[model samples]
Target: MNDKPLSGRKAQAARNDKLILEAAREVFVADPEAPIAEVAKLAGVGISALYRRYPSKEDLLRKLCGDGLARYTELVREALESEGDLWGAFREFLRKVVVADTPSITVRLAGTFTPTSDMFEAAVAADELNRALLARVKDAGVLREDVENGDLALVTESVSSISLGDAERTRELRLRALELYLEALRAPGAGPLPSSAPSEEEMGARWVPKQAK
Candidate 1:
C-alpha cells in the first residue's frame, strides 16, 4: 500500500510515464492520428500501461504539447536573458529553438487535441517572451520593421519540414537553412519582404483543438 516513489511499483510507474510521454511526443508529431498502440510499441511499454498513464490519445496529445510548450517558454526566457549584443542574442535564440524543434511541436500538432489550462498559459508566456525579445532588437535598430510575431514560427517550421534521412542529417540541414533565415531576419539587408505575417489570432485559432474551436 506504500505510495512513495521509493517503492518499486511507484518507481516503475514513474518510468512508464516518462517512456509513454517520450514516445507520444515522437509518434504524435510524426503522425498525430497514429494509433495509441504505436506509442506503446515505440516506448517499449505495454499498451495497458500507456492507457493507464494517458487514458486517451487526446490526453497524450495534450501532455506532449504542454511539455513542449513549457520547454519552449524556458528556451525563450533563456534567450532573452542571454549575454550578447541584441542581434546576436536574437540570432542565437532562433538557432537554439530550431535545433530543439520546439516550434515544430505546436506547428505540427495544432488542432489535434484540446490544450489544458497550463498549456494555454505557457503558449501566452512564450508569445510574450518572443515579443519582448523582438522588441529589444527592433528598439536597437537591428530587426526589420516588417517582422512580426508569427514569422519566427513559420521560419522554424519551414526548417523542420526537412525530415529527410537520419536525425543528424536532418539537423545539419536545418541549421544550414536556419542560417539563410537568420540572414534575412538580420537588419539593413533586404528591401521590404513581400506579403504580411498572419495575425497571432489567425494563427492561434489553429492551435486550439477542433472540438474547442
Candidate 2:
C-alpha cells in the first residue's frame, strides 16, 4: 500500500467540485436549457469530471436549485434581522431574490420538482423562515390581520420571480404587489390613521434602480 495520506488529494478534489458547481450554476441561470457539454466547458472541467460529480442533467439542476434556495434563505434571514420594519425587511428580501442570478433557479424549479429530498428540505427551510418572519410582523401589528401565513407565502413566491427586468422595474412590481397585499390586510380604515402615506419620492428612493448606462 502507498504510504502517502490522501488528505491533500481529497481537499483538492473538494475545491474542484466547488468550482465546477459554481460554474454550472452560472450557466444554468444564463440558460436553463443549455447542454451539459456547454456547462462542463463553462465550469472549466471536462465532461468526464462533470459526469463524475453529477451523473445527469436533472441531478445537476436539482443541486443548483437546492444551493440557490439555501443562499436565498440566508439573505431572507439577514434582511429580517437587519430591518426593523416588516415591510422593509420583506422588500429587501424580494430585492435580493430578484437581483441574484443564482437565486433564479428557485423560481425556475418552483412547482415543478418535489423538494422532499435532503437538499430540497434544507431549501424549504427558507420558506418556513419567511412564514415565521411574516407571523412576527403580523403580531407586531405592522402587517394587517387578514393576511394569513399562506397568503404571505404566496406573495413571497410571486415576488421572487420578478427577475426578467431591471432592478427599477422589478422594485416597482414589488411595491405594487406589496401595496395590494397591505390593502387586502387593512380593515376598511380601522387601523391607525396614516398622517401621510408613502410619498412618490420615498417609494422611488426605496427602490434603487439598476446602474444605467
Candidate 3:
C-alpha cells in the first residue's frame, strides 16, 4: 500500500476533525457555552486546528444543531417504520428523545432556533412526523386522546425544569422523571393533570446552567 503526502495529510485532517466534533459535543452537552479552547483541549488538538475546522463557537453550534436535528428526525422515522407494536415504538421514541445520545443538546435546542437551511427543513419534518406518530397512538387508543403535540413539547421541556443533583446524576434523574410522565400518558385510568403548565420563560431559565449563560 502507498500513502501519498496529500492523502496522508487529508486522513490526518479528517481524524482531527472527528475528534474535535466529538469533543465539542461532549463539552457542549455539559455546558453549551463552553469556550472553543476547552473543546480543543478535550480533543487533544491545537486551538489552531479547532478553529481551522470550526471558525467560531457559533459555527460549531450550527453544525451540531443541524446534525442533531437530522439524527433525531431519523430516529422518529425509524420508530414509525419499524414492524413492531405501535405502543412500544411510541415509548421507544420518548425514551430515546429524552435520554439517549446527545439528548442534552437536543433538549437544549428543542423548539428553539433553526441554525441552518437544512436544520430548518429537518425541524419542520420532525414536527410533522411527531404529530403523525402521536395521532397514530391516539387513534389506536394507546395514548390518551388529550395528548396533543404540545403535551410532548411540554414533556421534553420539562427535562430542564428541575435539577436533581450533579451532571453525572442528571441522566438518571431525567429518565426516572420521564417514566412517571409516560405512565401519566397512558389511555386507561389516567388521572387529571394540573390545569396550568410551566411557561416558556420559566423553562428557558432552567434549561441552561448559570455558568453557561
Best by TM-score: 1
Model 1, poorest ten-residue lDDT window? Answer: 2-11
lDDT at residue 213 of model 2 (Cα atoms): 8
TM-score of model 2 vs. true structure:
0.59
Would you estimate the TM-scores of all the predictions?
0.91, 0.59, 0.76
Overall lDDT per candidate, in order of appearance: 0.84, 0.63, 0.73
Model 2 C-alpha lDDT per residue in residues 1-213, reported as the tens digit of each score? 897755987877787788788887767666766788888787677899889888988788777777776777788788668656766776566556555644356445443333336764674576578667767777776666555544544455565566547767876776666566556554443665445433334422321322320
RMSD after CA superposition, every candidate: 3.1, 11.5, 5.3
Model 1 lDDT per residue over 1-213, tens place: 976556798888988888888888888888888999999999999888888878998888887777778777888898788765878878777788888887678777899877777777777888999899888788888888789888888898899888878999989999999999988987876798888897888887997777775
Predict model 3's lDDT versus the native: 0.73
User: Which residue ranges in model 2 land beyond 4 Å of their true spot?
Assistant: 1-15, 80-83, 101-103, 110-116, 148-213
**Candidate 3: segments with Cα more than 4 A from true spot:** 1-7, 101-103, 106-114, 160-170, 189-213
